[model samples]
Target: MLRYVINRIIVALPVLFGVLVVTFFLIRLIPGDP
Candidate 1:
């Protein structure tokens, strides 16, 4: 259903944001810039 899809997307947004933040920090921690 449309509502289910919307709910899933809402839930995934935070997880996606978390992943982006973690990745950004991890990349910054690398010894050399890419």
Candidate 2:
């Protein structure tokens, strides 16, 4: 159980990082009018 959770976190970290980076770049590219 604990090992499974740890492995899941390890696998998810890179994916989460990628998403965050992409979103950051997208926000930067978009206009600032909301």
Candidate 3:
């Protein structure tokens, strides 16, 4: 159903955001600048 798909996407959004935030922090921890 459309509702089920929407719910799944809503759940995924936060996970995706968390991954991005973690990646940013990891990159910041690196010694060298880009």
Candidate 4:
């Protein structure tokens, strides 16, 4: 259903943001510049 899809997308947004933030920091923490 359209509502279900929208709800899923809303829920996934925060998780995606978290992943991006964590990945960014992890890459930044690498020994050599990435």
By TM-score, how accurate is candidate 2?
Answer: 0.82
Provide the lDDT at 25 for model 1.
Answer: 94
In candidate 3, what are the lDDT values of residues 1-34, reduced to their tens digit?
9999999999999999999999999888887766
Clashing pairs in 3: none
Best by TM-score: 4
Q: What is the lDDT of residue 1 in candidate 3?
A: 100
Question: For model 4, what is the C-alpha lDDT against the true structure?
Answer: 0.94
lDDT (CA) for every model shown?
A: 0.95, 0.98, 0.95, 0.94
The estimated TM-scores of all candidates read 0.84, 0.82, 0.82, 0.85
Off by over 4 Å in 1: none
lDDT of 1 by residue, 1-34 (tens): 9999999999999999999999999888887855
Task: List, residue by residue over 1-34, the lDDT tens digit for candidate 2.
Answer: 9999999999999999999999999999998888
Better of 2 and 4 by TM-score: 4
lDDT of 2: 0.98
Can you tell me which runs of candidate 2 are displaced by over 4 Å?
Answer: none
Q: Per-residue error at 8 for model 1, in Å?
A: 0.4
Which model scores highest in lDDT?
Answer: 2
Worst 10 residues of 3 by lDDT: 25-34
How far residue 22's Cα lies from its native spot in candidate 4, in Å, is: 0.2
